[model samples]
Structures are given as structure tokens and as C-alpha cells.
Target: MAQGEKGGRASRVRIWVGLFAVAGGALLVGDPAQRGETALELVGRWWPWTLLALAGLNLLRSAVPVGSLIGPLALGAVGVVGLVAVHGLQAHLVRDQLAPALLVATGAALVLSSDRMGLRTSWTRLLATGDVVVPPSVRCPVTLRAVLGELRADLGEVRGQVEVNVTAIAGHVRLTVPRASTVQVNAQGALLTRLPTRPSEFTRQPHSEGEFTIHVLGVCGAVSIARV
Candidate 1:
């Protein structure tokens, strides 16, 4: 297929995926009883919403190329609506459902836009010395020491060598890197690692070349690395 056609198909896929995410979120918040469940439980049950939101956001940001303010505003709106619907109403209503659904839908739309516009990775390195939640697709290296808090890495091309450390606390770490990147993950926590199904020549081992380094220090949670 032509590059444009392939791109179009990817765009459509993002849209449909976003729609499904919205629908799934609607189901979770549609029932107030779901709120009775613990936050962890709810998150576990509706984890897909979070993934959908991330993918949608990533995609949307790329497509529209909007200012930074708009992204935060949209995220805040989704959080508010999700929280209100899940906590405010005692009785279930379509409106309650709509809030979460829209949140997911908006996320989906954002994802579609982002993918089309080709904005996939952030150049900034985020360090959170507390409980940090990360996506499933991240690549982690095993060279740095451990610390207290959570660390997450959204994968991209690695131009150099990297080291990550996880300190003596329980937290989460996520890494996303290009397939050509080398990764070493050394952790005491029960790690949940995610990688692309297809094998690539990039991340087969540690590299001697020095390009970029990603390091994480934390206690416990979950660690995920998605190879680009």
C-alpha cells in the first residue's frame, strides 16, 4: 500500500481504538456500585481506560499540534468528569455514564490526531520520587542503583548508553525505547515487563556507543518497557 494509504489506515485504527476505550470507560462508571470497589480494584477492572487514554492522548497531541495548555486542560477535564461521576452520584444515570465515556472518547480523538500529526515521544525526562504509574510499553535498563519513589520512561530512539536504578522502595518503572536500544533491567520488585512481539535487531544487548541514557530509581509497583 501507498504510504498515505497506510497512514490513513493507522489513523482510522486509532479512532476506532479510542471509541472502544470510551465505551469501556462508560461501562465502568455507569454503575455506582463499581465505585464501592477499592481504587486499586477499580483501576484493575478498568485499566484499559487508562491505556486508551494514553494512546488517545499521544495520538491526539500529534495530530492537532495544539499548545501545551490545551493538553493539560483536556486531561483535567477528563479527570474531573471521571471523578465526579464515580463519586458524586448515588444513583446511576446516563449522564454519569456520559462523563466517563466522553473522557475516553476525547482521549481517543486526541490519539487519532496525535498519530496523524506524528508526535509520538517527549524529549523531556520525568523523574517522580513518589508513587508513579506508567504505561505497559517501556524499556528499562539494569545498571543504576535503586531509590525511593516511582520512575517512568516513554520509549524513543536511543542515541547513547543508559542506566536505571531502583532504590529500596516499592514503586513502578516504565521504559519505551527504539528496538535498536540496549536495555538491562535489574530489580527486586516483581516486575511486569512488556515488549513488542516482533523481534528487532536494535535492543538485543547493551551498546558500546554513547547516545542517551534513561535511569529509574524507585521501590515497587510495576515496570513496563515498549520497544519502538
Candidate 2:
């Protein structure tokens, strides 16, 4: 199972890399100068497409569950908002502020709808340190957000499938899980990440007993997962 997961991840990465390379090649071959346009002008017209591509990638990374729709939906909405501001309306103010406004609104909506969304625990820390431990009785999604601090989450007692979303900025995050869990990690942005590679530690585990799916976003931070 571990080998299959690795193969799938590698293939997805290859596909995305190939698509980006092709797009880059096309841009270089079709010089903006030849079209009587500056590089900025070209970017102004094509930036929405880049956002759409990212939305698609995020959707692919998401699990096949209802909770997974949130990220893609937000990204797609931002991309649509960008398109409208850049081309349909051509409002500089809207282009500059609308996407961020929408993102903030989405976050607020998530907080309001957490109960309906089956979020069991939500933790946010700014310039602080803390730990979150999930007991075996809880079987819902968990969210961890941190900025300029450290956080640790222990899921060693969780008995079944669990979903965790983590966001960190200039901080460190450590996750401890049962060794029998089949852990799947999807991450965005630059992060120093470490996970056990030894087959005996995780690869040999049966997927039916315990599972952990984690989505991570980090900026100039580190994340590590330990199996116990």
C-alpha cells in the first residue's frame, strides 16, 4: 500500500511538472514583445488561469470526501473573482482587494459552520506554544493553525480514520500517531518535512485498522510526523 501511494504521488508530481514546463515553454516561445505587449500586461491577462490551475491541483490533492471540497471551492471562487476583476470589470480596486476579501469571508464562514462540518476540534495559536491530544472517542476532523510558534498534536489514541488540516507560518509542528495508522500527507508551500521511511515503521501496517489524512500548508516552517 505504501509503495502504491508513493507511486501515485510521484506520477501526480510528474504530470504537474510537465504541464508547468509546457506552459513555460509556450510563454517563452510566444514572446510578449512580438505581440506588442509588456510582460506585466501579459501576466495581467493570464494570472487567473494560473489560479485556476492551482485550484485544480488542490482539488486533486483533496480526499474523496465532503470536507475536501472546501479548499478547492475557495480557490476556485478566488480565481473566478480574479477573472471578473481582471477582464469583465477591469476594476483595479476590485482586483487588488476582492480575492483577499473573499478568502477572509470564507474563513469566517468555516468558523461559523464548524459544528455542521463535523469539526471536533479547532486550535489556533499566534506567538504561543501548545499541544492538542485527540482521544480515542473523537472521530471528527481537526484543524490546527499556528504563527511564529510551536505546536504538537498527538493522535496516538485515535482508533479509526481521522482528518487533520494544519497551517503554520514560521513555526514548527509535530504530529504523533499510532504506528498502525496508514498516514497520507499532502502539503503546500515551502516546509521542512520529515516522516519515517523505514518499512517496518509504517509500510507494513494494514490500512484497515487506522488511517490518518493530513493536509499541511506552511511558510518558512517545519513539520514532522512520528509513529509510536
Candidate 3:
């Protein structure tokens, strides 16, 4: 698309993210008696599915007038198989194996549906095994998708106003950038979405050059951004 359109879309994403943050903050400050359930229970349920929420965003990455059906189909298949294998039957697709299986299945679905999903290898990064590299020389906007995967993006070479969008459904995404990189963690989840005010937490926001903007959405996963 054109530069202005891309900028507009990016701004819209930021607006939605800001709205989500504001709503979450309001929920915390609002009354407990009227909210029905206790805050603790609400948090507990949300914590586990935090990163999984990224799947919703993924499905929308390349949408159309009708809608993006790949996400629901793929995830539904995974859910059905997982449910049947784990809970429906006595199948052992649970515990430790579940995460890996989901990752593999997710990757497969995306690749298989690449034709319709607008999944061009050029602008998107998919990691199924080891680290994911963000070309140090290229300064284009990109999306990173990792399932049962590990992402190590080197953004120290990025210049200009570039957007780095990340969606991790069931794995860890680590970003290595200059110390001056600005990190905005608008991750949607139930609890502890922001890096706690601790030095050990790597997802914490860092100083920025105001050029590289990072938008990370994780579900049932984690993202750590640190200096290169």
C-alpha cells in the first residue's frame, strides 16, 4: 500500500492499543461489587490465555471484505484435536507436548494457507526452530510470527521510522536492539502483561531513538527486549 495508508493503519493499531490499556486501567480502578466476579479470579483466568490472544490479531493481519477465516479454521482445528486428544479421549497430547504440538500445527496452517493469508516471505518472519533474524540492512516494516519457537531479532541496524510488530502465540520472542531503542509493550493478556518494575524483567521498556517503534502482542507467551 501507499506510505500514508500504512501510517494510518499503524496509527489505528496504536489507538486501539491505547484504548485497551485505558479500559484495563479502568477495570482495575472500578468497583468490584458491580463487576460480578472478584478481581483475583478475573486475573487468574486471563493470565494463561494472554499470549494466545495474539492469534486474534494474526487472523486480522491480512483480512478482506468478507473476513479472514484462516485463523479460526486453523486454531479451531488445533483446538478440536487438542481437546479430543487431551480431554475427549485418553490421548497423551497434553502437559509438555501440547505447546510444541500447537506451535507446529500453527506454523503448518499458516504456511499451507499462505496463498490466501497474504503471507509473503519477504515482509514476514516465521520461526519454527531457532532464532528469527531481522535483517540488519533492511529498514522495512515487518511482522514476526512464532509458534513453539524462539525469536531473536537484531534491530540495532534499523534506521528511520520502522514498525516492528510481533505476535507470539506459544513461544518466546527476544529482541536485541540498541540501548536507545524505544519499547512499547502493549501486550494483551490477563495478568502481569507489563514487565514488572524489576531489573531482571527483560520486557521492560528502554530508552529510545524515537525512530524504531516496537508493537508486541503476545498470547500465552513471553517477549524479552534487551540491548544487543
Candidate 4:
């Protein structure tokens, strides 16, 4: 799916989730006799996890659609496994060793396979040389990771406002999009973020129609999204 489409869907999900929470809160504050205690107990126990999974599903899917996403996805999976080992599996010793081992494995997988699908390997390799322009023909959402390099991706012809997941590790990434296109930015784990003037807050799109949603994760790197 295109970036904006995915973001729009996620946005709707957030809205519904928020409304549910508000309604639930109201119910909590209301007299308990109106409803049976059993329903309340059931929802109370599972509501938090349900919401977490609902949001996490979209976050992970949107942020890491490419094969490289497997790295972070695997990382999350390993974390869940570790939790199971520590609590469910009752393997405390394994917990101590799990983190370092998983880190090494994830790093190796990243180096070996940026995209196991092998679709955008060459295009991404251009990052090693610095300043690569995204072809207009490539309309689908893509994940770009930069290490000590730069990206010159243009979002002019992007029909869906480009759903590009950018990971900057001590690298500089630049995006050139249409001035008319509303650009929405969602940043996390960033040391710093420089966005357009009047840019909406994280996950907030003020001018969403025909806009781009760029998901950025920076580790000691910089990102700039300019309207050209």
C-alpha cells in the first residue's frame, strides 16, 4: 500500500480506539449496577493488551514493509520470546544471554539482507555513493536505510504521497516533495528532527489530502523534508 493510504487507515484505527477508551472510561465512572461485574472484569484485564496489539500491528507493518523490516520485526519477536522464556518458559538464565545473541543475529541479517525480496537492492545501494533520486515509476511504499550517506528521494509523482520508511544511522536523508502535497511526519527514536514550517505534530496530519507520511527513525542522524 502507498504510504498515505497506510497512514490514513492507521489514523482511523487510532480514532476508533480513542473513542472506545473514552466510552469505557465513562462506563467505569458510571454506577456498576447497570452492567454485570463479569463483563467489566473481562474487559479490564484484556483491554490494554488489545489496544497495544491493535496499534503495534499497524506501526510495525507501516514502518517496516521491506525485507529489511525483518530485522526490527525479528527484534520485537525475540523480545516477546525472551519475555516468554523469563515468565512463561521460566528460563531466567536464557534471558541474560538472549539480548546479546539476538543483537548479533539481527545485525548480521541486516548486513546480509537489506531486502530479501531483492527488488530495491540496487537502488538502495546508491546510498553508499550518496544522493540518489527515486524513480517516479516506483510508486509503492519503500523502506530506505542510510548509514553514513544521503538520499535524494523526490515525491512529486508519488500518487499516494509516498509512504517511505526512512532509517538514518549517522546519515543525512533528504526528501523533495511537491509544495502542494501536505506532508505528515511521524518521528520516533530520533535524536533530532527538522521538519517543514507548520508541519503537523507526530501522527497528526493537518492537511492530509494528497499528502505524504514519512516514518523516520534516526540514530544520531538528520532528516529534512522539503516541498519543492
Q: How many pairs collide in each candidate, listed in order? A: 43, 0, 6, 1
Q: Which portions of model 3 miss their true places by more than 4 Å?
A: 1-127, 136-139, 189-210
Task: Indicate the TM-score of model 4.
Answer: 0.40
Q: Cα miss at 115, model 3 (Å)?
A: 20
- Runs of candidate 4 exceeding 4 Å displacement: 1-127, 192-209
Badly placed stretches (over 4 Å) of model 1 are 1-151, 167-170, 188-218
Please provide, for model 1 over 1-228, each residue's C-alpha lDDT reduced to its tens digit, 9 standing for 90 to 100.
245545766797798899988866776685646653654586797788766655455445434443553666678667766776778844355355546765565544443333222322211122222112222332334322223223344435344555544332343444556665555543324334222232222345554332333333343444466666
**Candidate 4: count of backbone clashes, pairs at least 3 residues apart or interchain:** 1
Provide the lDDT at 50 for model 1: 68
Per-residue CA lDDT of candidate 2, range 123-202, in tens?
Answer: 65555455567667664577777676566778888877788887878777778988777877776444564323431232
1-228, model 4: which lDDT tens digit per residue? 355545655686698799989877777676656554756776798677655543443344334433655657687767768778677865664554455445544553454333223123123422232334555556556667666555556666555556778777776677777666666777755666454454445333465435567787788777787766
Q: What's the ranking of the predictions by TM-score, best on top?
A: 2, 4, 3, 1
User: Which 10-residue window in model 3 sums to the lowest lDDT?
Assistant: 115-124
- By lDDT, rank the candidates, best first: 2, 4, 3, 1
Candidate achieving the largest TM-score: 2
How does residue 170 of candidate 1 score in lDDT? 45
TM-score winner, 3 or 4:
4
* Lowest-sum lDDT 10-residue window in model 4: 114-123
lDDT of every predicted structure (CA atoms): 0.45, 0.63, 0.53, 0.58
